[model samples]
Target chain A: MTGLVSLFRRLEGPQTLGRGPAFWALFALVLAGALAYPLFSDGYTVGNTVYFFVWVFIALSLSLIWGYGGSLSFGQTAFFGIAGYGYGILTINFGAAYGFTWIALLLAIGMAALVAALLGYFMFFGRIAGVFLGIVTLAVTLMLERFMAQTAGPEWRIGAARLNGFNGMSAMPPLTIPWFGGPIPLFADVGLYYVVLAMLVLVYLGLRILMNSSFGNVIVAIRENPERAEMLGYDIRKYQLITFVIGAALAGLSGVLYTVWGQYITPSSMGMTAASLPLIWVAVGGRSDLTATVIGTLVVLSGFQALTIYGSQYALVFMGVLLVLTVLIAPNGLVLGVIKGITKLVTRRKQEAA
Target chain B: MALLQLRDVNKHFGGLHVTNSVNLVLEQGEIHCLIGPNGAGKSTLFRLILGEHHPGSGQIYFAGEDITTLKSFARIRRGLSVKFQVPGVFKGLSVRQNLEIALQSRLHGAALDKEIDRLLAFLNLEAEQAQLAGNLSHGQKQWLEIGMAIALKPRLLLLDEPTAGMSPEETHMTGEMVRRLNAAGMTVLAIEHDMAFVRQVAQRVTVLHLGQVFAQGSIDEIVADERVAAIYLGQAHA
Candidate 1:
């Protein structure tokens, strides 16, 4: 894993640029591993892995928004929930047929983007940044949780869908896409896992390409220092708003996928623990590098689930200790922290040889 | 019409009047230096010009257009760009990437490479082109920032304290660069504390005190004014 991570880092640097025979080799190996997952794991295992991939998508969005875009959001789950509910309402009557599922997926992403744009317009244009942004976003998330939880009556139903209070909208049909066959359901456990994994990889690659573009350069510049970027004639607010929408779209996509996987959407998904999950994931991974963020999310999240499965009384304690250690020793996140140490060791060894 | 003008601009932060009916102008192709002590509102006036703060009451005209209500980026699009007190280069990026971003603002395609090279050469930062901007020394960072401001293809360049923490040699070089830019037909409006730098580059100087223009004249004329000595030079003699 460490060797592959180092290879990934090399690929990120401009010189490698994600090409070269070694990169292709690593890519093939990872592809083989992902494809052969069903051989080694059961349907339940694949399902949970898909579940984990859903969070990974959200984690990547957070990394982009906070890490590169410089907008720390504690409420990204708000957008995720927005999409979940939006998808549920849009596709509820059709039961994943008539291709409404695809339309609903797009609409869910669009709704999240539009909402994010509005939120960003208000927050950034008002010059509400830094910790203030986090506070505002968290407030939005908590507000959604409370708002959705209160819809206990039949009046809360949109079309055939119901905002079923804490029980959530259960038995929502699985999302199906236009395959070689007409509108095939992605409900099969292994198939759903692959779909989620493919989306994750695609989103990852898309964001990577974007960060290398001039647009990405400009936004990151705005992130580093808004005033400086402003003086240079870049509209800081515009960049922030645009990136906010993109991140929201990604989150919305993740939420849609999660709803499909879980077969239900809930108000508690945006509650305290769930809302803060990505924060721990990205922070533990390190926000500086995208690869680190993904790895960190997988490692910590899997460990967390393992602890829960064993019914360890110290599960929460263990999570806290891991986070605290990352904050102290790694600070950059465990992946990058470990990478940095490795690079230093290599350089020292080279020096000794010299 | 002046290249840049502020007429009857009034800005007050509650009781503290940061700008009081202040009127200033930078003529085309001239190096105009605004100089004052710490509380003289020099920076505030610069902000007002850069659209960082809108004047409470007044008009700002740039290149014969009313730009009083314009945003900072809009004002910049109108050919006004600024370099702040701190160096404004994108530190995480390479020096070339920093210049490339600025170059991209006005130029694109194959032209960008040539422009980036020209800017790097102009600022004598060609050697540091591949280095991270944050790793550059103070003088080089300032030069890189200046390079960025000019890369905007600004008709009027606003620089705040360009030589604040420079070595004397670097200060001289910066003064020379300012003169070179002015000669190249860029209207320069600079707020500076280095009197020697102002003497080297300024065609005309404006002195402000207590949020208002105290005097405006040729550098020598301002130096000859007794009030300027008592107020700006901190002399007891009047």
Candidate 2:
């Protein structure tokens, strides 16, 4: 019981925003609204909203990697693409009977995490940091994209699945629960939406708990100053590697979900453009704060979708301009800055009343 | 056993020898100071001891164990801690959070909170615990870092220029804090420039010139040494 109380207390750590009774009340209200969203909306719009949520995992991963861990990585999309393709190959080859797709999902995520551990071990343990770390991650992302884009030959077959090259591998099975009355497919509809929603909530809260833990405090210390953290008896490389693997696994979760949603996996998901897009999503939303990243990701994704539909040529241009403006004006993040302003105002008013 | 022993340690950067065959030892329960002129490699020697930089040739032993190849964090885990020349505080974190990071490895729950409280009171930073370390005054930041090092409860504490940016009053207070820490069975090796602060705290002193140990004696004997006065004290005042 005391453990539970301490966990609740940790939810209000200084590294994140929105806490106390009011914040929880507001969070509950928002969650309730989301739970009730499909009741009022059409099926198509609800499915599209699931797409927006799918990308939030990637954004949150970047937030953890860059914002708190202080290591900029463009390799998240690589992990996403790896998991997506891994899911496709496994399901296409073995077939999704008896809910093997669930096991496959775990395996796919595991594959991405393994690759991340290998890559992160070299990068962090080798002591590559700052912009050089960025450069290395970008190189790895692009290298994977290029390698996957060329597997167009018949030799690219893995059991029953083909690497279809730039067209991507398609027609994979959706995630299924082994229900008593046969398997239930989560086809990006309201069912999948709820599952993804539950995941997001759990992940967000889990991150809050983790960020407030002793491990979390040490990482922030490393982010502030690696040498000082080392002198304080921390193996900074180990912490950084663990953080990177966690971020990669989350990205893998997104990849698996996205692939399951469309029943397709593509190399373009790990392309240079796709890799940089998450950076913008994370940076413009305030890279340091998870809440800001979530809000910013949803808002910007909606805006980008609208631009892509109406003014296709201007979509990338709009994103680039928005990124520039974010760096110039509210570098900490526009959403986070607004939240801080309101918090300060409320605190001052309460103080004055006292 | 001596708390720390460095034998024939040499470090070079290209052709320039930074630490030249430096041999030193610190007995347990002593407050020792390292004084040197510019480019005398005093800081470099500290780095070698901390294992931030390995010696080109030689051995470092701590508590009768050879730790020459041990990484900085490993050495630190064996009861070694340091307050760097710069105030290496987690500037973005609160002052209390800074100490929490230090004590979190071996402490938890109420014990963690209790230790944090003790450190805050020790540093006289109870009032500023909630303030961001970056926002603290220069002296406060230094004190907070000292508190962080002390939070580790190290057997050997290395303090590099602990009073670099402090006023005379603050420097005197720092000397008192160091003496207090030493009195509590903590051995300290401090690299300091202030003669007054050294006189106030140091029981023994070592003078380095051009990366070589020039003199080692009582503070008064070192102060009275014409050669140390000619090389270090004279150059410091210049």
lDDT of 2 by residue, A1-354 (tens): 988999978887878888888999999999999999999998778888999999999999999989999999999999999999999999999989999999999999999999999999999989999999999989999999999999998899999999988889999999988898888998878988898999999999999889888888987898999999999999999999999999999999999999999899889899988998889988889889999999999999899999999886699889999999999999988888888899999999999999
Clash pairs detected, candidate 1: none
Interface root mean square deviation per prediction: 1.2, 0.4
lDDT of candidate 2 at residue A294, scale 0 to 100: 97
- For candidate 1, the share of real interface contacts preserved is 0.78
Candidate 1, residue A87: lDDT: 89
For all candidates in order, the CA lDDT equals 0.84, 0.93
| DockQ-derived CAPRI band for the predicted complex in model 2 | high
**Interface RMSD (one decimal) of model 2:** 0.4
lDDT of 2 by residue, B1-238 (tens): 5999999999999999998889999999999999988789999999999999998999999999999999999999999999999999999999989999999998998899999998899888999999999999999999999999988899999999999989999999999999999999999999999989999999999999888898999999998888888885455432
Lowest-sum lDDT 10-residue window in model 1 chain A: A9-18
